[model samples]
Target: MFSFGLLNLFQLFFLACFCEPAHALAPGSSRVELFKRQNSTVPFEENNGT
Candidate 1:
């Protein structure tokens, strides 16, 4: 029973982090927004100048 509760607590933490507004998670930190922006940013490709 204790293990189940622990698991639930972790799940709740993830849900809150993913569901809450970016500002709510970190007041003025913009951590969540940074993650969202990272997902949309283009990844750099290896430029092998042959």
Candidate 2:
């Protein structure tokens, strides 16, 4: 019984570690996609002191 409980705790720890990164990466990927679009549309204009 004690070993069963330990196994369950380990499973939850792995699940938490896996899920946290999946959640973090989803937004980062979208941000990179948006940056690509912005760069494509905006020309690299040097701002002469306006």
Candidate 3:
């Protein structure tokens, strides 16, 4: 249970690191585009697939 909570925290951190730049770089961009950009750079998603 403790590890699960830690994993959630890590996910949030990664999300912040990932989304923050998109907002800074293009504040006017649509959310759909930001999501596509995020999906393209999924370091964790690749690992999960393996």
Candidate 4:
């Protein structure tokens, strides 16, 4: 049980270290963008403008 706990701790530590670079350079990543689209049609709106 102790070994399992130790392994889990090491895994968590490795993940924390691995993710550091992502957050450090997050602002410069061009693939990241923010956009919003608005749909004005009501839920019950008819398909044709009848």
- Report, for every candidate in turn, its global Cα lDDT versus the true structure: 0.74, 0.78, 0.76, 0.65
The TM-score of candidate 3 is 0.51
Candidate 3 lDDT (Cα, whole model)? 0.76
Sorting all predicted structures by TM-score, with the top scorer first, yields 2, 4, 3, 1
Name the 10 consecutive residues with the lowest summed lDDT in model 1: 21-30
RMSD of each: 9.8, 5.9, 15.2, 11.3
lDDT computed for candidate 4 = 0.65
Give model 4's TM-score versus the native structure: 0.51
Q: Write the per-residue lDDT of candidate 1 for residues 1-50, one digit (tens) a residue.
A: 99999999999999888877655667546686567567876764545974
Q: How far out, in Å, is residue 32 in model 4?
A: 13
> Stretches of candidate 3 above 4 Å error?
27-50
Per-residue C-alpha lDDT of model 3 across residues 1-50, encoded as one tens digit per residue: 99999999999999999998777668546776567767886543433656
The alpha-carbon deviation from the true structure for residue 39 of candidate 2, after best TM-score superposition, in angstroms, is 9.9
Each candidate structure's TM-score, on Cα atoms with residue i matched to residue i, is 0.39, 0.54, 0.51, 0.51
Residue range with the least summed lDDT across 10 consecutive positions in model 3: 41-50
Q: What's the distance in Å from true for residue 19, model 1?
A: 0.8
For candidate 2, the TM-score is 0.54
Best by TM-score: 2
Query: What would the per-residue lDDT of candidate 4 be over residues 1-50, giving only the tens digit for each residue?
Result: 99999999999999999998787657645333221113334344444978
